[model samples]
Target chain A: MNERDALRALAADLPHAGDDAAVVDDTVITTDMLHERTDFPPGTSRYTAGWRAVGASLSDVAAMGAAATAAVVAVYADADFDEADLDRFVAGAVDVCDAVDAAYVGGDLDTHAEFTTASTAIGTLTDAGPVTRSGAAPGDALCVTGEWGRSAAALRLFDRGRDDAAADADAIGTVDASNGAVERANELFRFTPRVADGLALAPHATAMMDSSDGLARSLHQLGEASEVGFELDRDTLPVHPAVEAVTDDPAERFELAAHFGEDFELVCTVPESAVDRVASDCPGTLVRVGSAVAAEDGITVDGDPLPDRGYTHGTE
Target chain B: MNERDALRALAADLPHAGDDAAVVDDTVITTDMLHERTDFPPGTSRYTAGWRAVGASLSDVAAMGAAATAAVVAVYADADFDEADLDRFVAGAVDVCDAVDAAYVGGDLDTHAEFTTASTAIGTLTDAGPVTRSGAAPGDALCVTGEWGRSAAALRLFDRGRDDAAADADAIGTVDASNGAVERANELFRFTPRVADGLALAPHATAMMDSSDGLARSLHQLGEASEVGFELDRDTLPVHPAVEAVTDDPAERFELAAHFGEDFELVCTVPESAVDRVASDCPGTLVRVGSAVAAEDGITVDGDPLPDRGYTHGTE
Candidate 1:
C-alpha cells in the first residue's frame, strides 16, 4: 500500500479523512510535506522549496474551492542547516501565503537528519460548500486549468544533471542554447497553484481535484470515487509548449501530459452548458479534456485505454 | 541563529507569527514537531511517540484555554518504516485525541530518511478569549499544574540504557527493581496533557504557557512577554518523588525541578486572591511555586539564580 492507502486505512477509524483537507463545518484543513532529497533538485533555492511546500498544501484548499485564511508550517532541518537558507525558506513561505491572500502565522522548527517541510493551510469554504472529487456525473464535461507535462519535462532535465545549465540559460535570456530543454523545464518547475481559477470555477464545478498527481492518476481516482469513467480527447489535452521543446517524441510528450503530476491545476467536471463559462471565467486557460461516462465504460483517451503512467508516492 | 531565532525573526515580518497558535478570530491553531532521534529515546514505543507528538501540540491549545476541535498530523518515516508500527502510532494518536475530547480528523504520510512527526491542532477560544503568556500582573500568584523533574529524570535513565528494564518493571508491577530509576521515569514519560486543568484555570489565569521548556525558561519567557519577573519559593515547587529517588542531592533535584522541560503542565499566573480558588478548581495539584514581581526583581528561586539547564531543540 502507498502513503495514501495507509492514510486511508488509518482514517477509516477516525471521524474524517480522505478529502483534500478535513472540513470542520466552515474550515478547510490540509497538509503536505516536501523532503529535500525527493523535492529539491540542484539549483532549487530555499525560496522555491519553501514556496512549493506551502503552495503544495494550499493547492488542496483551492481544490476544495475554499479561501485560504492562514497557514502554519513545521520545518525540520539538519543541525548544520544554514540560517540564511532558513530565512529564505521562511521568506518563500510568507511570499506564497501573501500570493494566496492568507496570513503566514507561526510555526515550529527542529533538527533532523535532513531537511523536511510539513505545512498546514487553513481555509474557509464558500456558500457553495466544498467541491469534492466525488460529485462528477455521467454527463458532466471534464476540464483542467492550465497546460501539462512541464514538471515531468523539468524532472527529465534535472535527472540529466542539466538544471544548472537551465538556470544559466534563463539568467542570460538565451532560450535557444544547447541547454534550452533545461531552461524550459525550470519555468515549469516554478508553476503557481491555480487558486483563483479554482475559486472561479467552483460554483459551476460538479467535482474537482488538483492535478498534483499525474492527470491519469487523478482521473482514475475521480472515476473510482464518483463511480464513473471518462473519455478524454487526446487532441484536446493541453500539452505545455515546453514539453515539445524539451523532447521530440510526440508519444512521450502525450504520456507526460497524461501522467506527469505537480501541475497544481484544477481538474473539474462541469455541466456542458457551463463549460464555456468555466473556460472564460478561470484565470488560466481551461482545456476541454474529456467527458464523464458510465462506470462500465472505463477511462479512455481518443477511444483507447489510457495507460497508468501517473505518479504515486513511495512507489517510485 | 537557531531555528527558534529564525522563526522569531521571520515572524517579525508577518502579520501573525507569534502566540501559542495563530489565533484567527475565535480559533486557535498550533503546530509542533517530534523527531525520532531527539524526541524518542531507547525502548520508546511507536504508541508513545504518536501520543507525545499529538499531545505536545494540543498542550499549546490548552495553554490558550481553547476547546480543541480537531487535529491533523504529518508523518515522515524511512522506506523501511514498519506497517504495524505505523498502525500503533495512529492508534495512539487517535486515543490521545479521544482523551482530550477532540477528533483526529486526518493527516499526511510520506517516506523520509528518518522518522519525524509534525502535528497541528485546532481549537476554539472560550469566553475568556486566549490566556496568553503576556497577561501576568505584578503581585499575581505564579502556579503550575502537577509536578516536575520527571522527563529529565527519564532522559537520564534512557541514557543509561535501562528503559527496557523500566518497562519490564512496570509490566510486573515491580517498583523496587535494581533499575527503579528507569521505571519511575517511564511512568513520567507517559504523561497526559493537563487539558482539564488548563480549561479550569483559564478563566482565572492572568497569563499561561505550557512548561515544555524548563520552568526557568518558561518563567523568563512569560516575564519577558508580560514585563514581570518572579520570586519562586524553592520549598513550594512540587518536585516529583522520582527526582529525589533518581538523584540523592537536594540541589541536583532542585535543578531538575527548575530546569527540566516537557512536563506538559500549565504554568500560569493568577491574582493572589484567586490562588486558592484555582488550586481548588484545577484537576491536578496546583503548586504555588512563585509570585509575579516587578521586571527588575528578576527570576529567582530561594533568592538564588536558577541555572539555565532546560531543554532546547537542535542543541544536542
Candidate 2:
C-alpha cells in the first residue's frame, strides 16, 4: 500500500480519519509536508517555498470552512543550507500568516540531508460548523471558487521564454506588479486557500473539498465519501485565460482545468436553492460547474469519462 | 542564527510564540521533526522511530501538563523505502498513542530522498492552566521527576560492546518483565514523556519545563524566562546507576546527568510549603536537587558554573 493507504488502514477506526482536518472540540488541525525536490521548482524563491508550505496546510483548514488561528512550522535543511534562504522562508511564512490574520507560532527546526518543510495549521469552526466531503447529496449543485489552470499555464510559460505573456495572462488583474505573471502564478501555485469563501459557503455547502489534488480527484473523493457521482459541464469549467493563451486546443485547456492540482480552490456541492446565494456571498468569482448524481451514474464530464490523473505524491 | 533564533526573530510579534506549544483556548499544539540521519541511530527499529517521533512532540505537551488528545504525523521517505518499515513505523506510532491515552489521528505521507518524520501533538489543558517556564520565582524548591543519565549511558553502552550493561542499569524496575535490562534501556532510549508527573505537579508547579534538552540547558531556559537562577546540589543530582556503570569518573557521570538530553523528565519549581506535597503526589521518584535563586546569582551546580552542553538539533 502507498503512504495514504497505509495511514488510512491504520486509522480506519479513528474518528475524523479521512476529513481534511481532524476536529477535536471546536478546533480543526491539519498538516502538510513539502519536499524541496518534489514541491519546489528550480527557480522557486525561498519566500515562496515558506508561503507555499504554510499555505498548503492552511488550505486544508479552509477546505473545512474553519477559521485558521495559528500555524506551527518545522523545517529541515542540509548542514550547508544558506542562512539568507532561511530568512526569506521565514519572511514568507510570517507574511502569509499576516495575510490570513493568523499567528506564526513557534516550531522545531533540524538538519537533514535535503530541505523539507512540515507545517500544521490550527483553526476553529464557525457557528455553522464544518463542511465535510461526505455531506453532499444527490442533485446538489457543484461549484468551484475562482479560476483554474493558471498554475499549469504558468508552468508552461516558464518552460517557454514568454515571461511577459505568462505574467500578463495569469494576472489577478494587477498591472505594474513587480513580479511577472509566471512568478505570480508560481506564487499562487498553491494559491490562497478559500478561507473566506469557505466560511461564507459553510452554511450552504452540502459537501466541500479543496482542489489541491485537482478537480477530478477531489470530485472523485467527494463522490466516494458522499456515495454520489458528479456530472460536469465542460463549458462551465472556468479555465483561466492564461490556460487559453498557453494551449492551442480548447479540450486541452479544459483538461488542464480538470486535472491540474494546487489551484487551492474550494470545490463544493451546495443545495440547488442556495447555489446563487453562496456564489453571491463568496468574496471571489464562483462558477457553477455541474451537479451531483446517483452513485451508479459515476463521474463524467459532458457525458464522457473523466480520468483521475491529478498529482498523487510519491507516484509523481 | 539557528532555527530557534530565526523563528523567534520572525514571530516576536505573536503572542505565546516562544512557549513549548502554542495555546489556543484549552488546547495545546506542538510539533517536532525527526530525521533519520540525525535522530535515528544505526539499528534503530522502525517501531522505535515512530514512537520517538511522536513521543518527542508529546513531551512538549507533557511539559505543560496537558492531556494529550491526538496526534497528526507527516512521513517523508524515499520512493523505495521498505513497506514493512512503514508498517512498523505506523504500528509504533499507534502503540505510543495508546500508551498515552491519545488517538493516533490520520496524517500525510509523501516520498522524499531521505526518511523524515514530523509529528504534531494536540492536547487539552487540565484544571490547572499551563505551567510555563516563566512562572518560577526566587526561592522555589527546584525539583525533577525521575532520574537522569540513562539515555547517555545507553549511548555509551551502545557505543561499546556492552549493550547488556547499558540496558541493565537503565531498566525501569523489571519487577515482572521478560525483556533484559539492556533491552529495557533500548526501549527507554526515547523514553516515555512525563505526562502523569507533569499533571500531578501542574497545580503546584511555579515553573515547569522538560529535560529534553538536558538539565543544565533547561535550568538556564527557566532562569532566563523566570528571571531566576538555579543552584543545583551535585550530591542531590539523581544520576542513574547506568551512568555510574558506564563511566568511572565522578565528575564525568555528573556531567552526563546534567548535560545528557532526551531523558524526557520534568524539571519544575515548587514553593517550599508545597514541596513535600508535590513530591508525594508524583507518580515517580521526585528528587529535590536545588532551589531557584535571584537572577543576579546566575545558574550553578555546587557553586560551580554549569555549562549548556545538551543535545541540540542541526548540530549533528
Candidate 3:
C-alpha cells in the first residue's frame, strides 16, 4: 500500500493518527522516516541529512502550535560506516535541537544496508490548546511564514553540480567548484522549524499546518480538513531569493514557489482583526497570502483553480 | 564507531543521553531501531516484528519505572511490501500498546530497500521520581521479573526449521510441519515488557534496568552505574520452559538462561526489607537471583566470576 493508504489504515486504529502530531494529554508527539535514496541526493553531507531529518519531525510539533521539548533520532547505517560522518550527523542534530532550545536526547543505532533515519519529537501544548487544521472559518486570513522555494533552489544547484562533474571527469582542479555548490545547497537545505512562530500564533491562528509538502498541497489539506476554501493573491506569495539564483522563467519560479516543498514554514489562518497582533507577536516574518472562503467557493489563485500538486513520498 | 562509542559521544553532548530513557521533568521517552537483517530470522512474520520493535521501546520506558502513555513507530519497507503483512504489523503494534494501556498513536511509513522500524515510547513518571541504574545500595536485593531464555529458544527453533527446510526441499507435504515450528518460534519470540513490574517496584527499588542484554551483562551495567557488585545464585535464576524444551544439556541451559538476551525482563535492586512487599505488589513472578555487594567484591555466579558478555550490535 502507498503511504496515504497506510496512513488511512493507521488512522482507523488511532483516533489522533491523522494530525501533524498526536496530542496525548498536554504532550504532542510525532515521528518521521527518511531514507537515504529518497531524502539525500548525491554530494549531500551527513550534517545536512541529520539536520533535515530531525527538523522534519520538529516541524510537525510546530504545526501543532506546541512548545518544542525534545527529540530523538534512530540512525541506521552500514556496519562499516565512516565514524567522522556519524559524528558530523550527530553534531548537526545537536545544533538543530539547540537552535530551537530543545534537547537532542539519545537514540538508537543499528546496522542496515542503507543509511536511514527515523526521528521522533515531543512538545508541550500551549495554553491555547492545539491549533488543529480543522478550525479555519470563512473570512479568516490565510498566511505563510518566511519565503518559499529554497529547497527547490538547492535541488537545482545539486543537479547543476552533478552535470558539471559529469562533463569534466579528468578535471581534478574543479573539485573545489563542485564542493562550493554542495556547500551552498546544504545551506539552503538546512531550515529552522518554526516552533516559536507556532507558539506565538497558537492563540490567534484559527488553523495551522506546515508547508513541508509545499504551499498548494498544504492549502488543500487545510481546506479539506477545515471544510473551507481559499482565495489567494499570487503576487503576495513570498519567493525565496535562492529561487531567482537558480531560475529566471516566471512559470518555473511559480512552480518552484508553490509546489516545491521542504520550506519548513507554517501555513496558518488568523482572523483579520488579529493579523496585526499576530505579526507583532511572531518571532519571524508572516505574509498574508489569502483569505479563507466558503467550502463551495473552492481554492483559487488569482481567480484560477489551484491544482493540488506537491511532494509526496514515492511508493515505487 | 561502535554503538557504545557513538552513545558515549552523544552522552557528552546531552546529560540525559546515557540512560535507557531520557527523563524530561515528568516525561520519560525512549527510541529503538531494529533492522530486518539482524533482528528477524528466516520465516519471521511482520506481526512479530511490529510487536518486538515497539516492545523494545516500551521496555526502556519500563526501565525508567514510569507509566507508559503512548508510542509511535516509523516503518520503512519496500514499495511493493505485502498489504496484509502491513496490516498484521499494525495490528500487532496496536495489541502490544493495548497490553500496556498505552496508546499506539500512529506513525510514519516510507519506502526503503529493507523492512526496518524505529519506535519511540513516552511515559509519565510516578511520584517516586524516575528510577535510574545508579541508585543501588550495596546490600540491596538483586531481582528479576519473569523467566529468561525464550528468545534463545526461539532462535534455535528458527535455525532448526531452516535446516529442516533445506534438507527436504521437495517435501511439499512438510509445509505444515515447518509452519508449526514457525508458529511456536513466534510464540516464544513474543514477550510482554515489564512495565507493570517496573511501576510496582518503583516505590521500593533503588536501581532498575531491563534485561534486553543477558542477566550477566545487565548486572554488570547496573554494577557500573550504581558502583555496586553482585553475588548471584545460579539455582535461583528462572529459566523459561521453552529453553528446556530446546536444550537438554545443563551447561547449555545455563548459558541460554544467563547469557542469551531479549528477555525483556526487569533487573532490579530493592532493599532487603522491601523484598516481600515488592513480591506482593508486582504483577508477575519475582525471582531473587542475587544480592548487591560492595564494588570491590566483584560480581559472581555460583562462586565463579560471571563474564561481562551479552548481545552487542555488530559494528564489523
Best by DockQ: 3
TM-score of chain B of 2: 0.89
User: Which tens-of-lDDT digit does each residue in A197-290 have in candidate 1?
Assistant: 8888879999999888889888988998899999999988888887886689989998887887877888889999999987898877888888
lDDT of 3 at B249: 95
Which scores higher on DockQ, 2 or 3?
Answer: 3
Residues A40-118 of candidate 3: C-alpha lDDT, one tens digit per residue: 7776788988899899999999999999899999988877776677778888888888888888887777777778889
lDDT per residue (tens digit) for residues B50-162 in model 1: 88889888888888888887888999877777678788888878878888888888788888776789999988888878888899999999999888887877877655545
Mark the regions of model 1 whose C-alpha exceeds 4 Å error after superposition.
Answer: A157-187, B156-187
TM-score of each: 0.90, 0.90, 0.96
Residue A105 local lDDT, model 2: 76
Q: Score the docking of each candidate (DockQ).
A: 0.61, 0.52, 0.69
Q: What is the lDDT of residue B111 in candidate 3?
A: 77
lDDT of model 3 at residue A122?
97
Residues A59-78, candidate 2: write the lDDT tens digits: 88889998888788888877
The CAPRI class of candidate 1 is medium
True lDDT of residue B54, candidate 2: 90
lDDT of 3: 0.87
Q: Let me know the DockQ for model 1.
A: 0.61
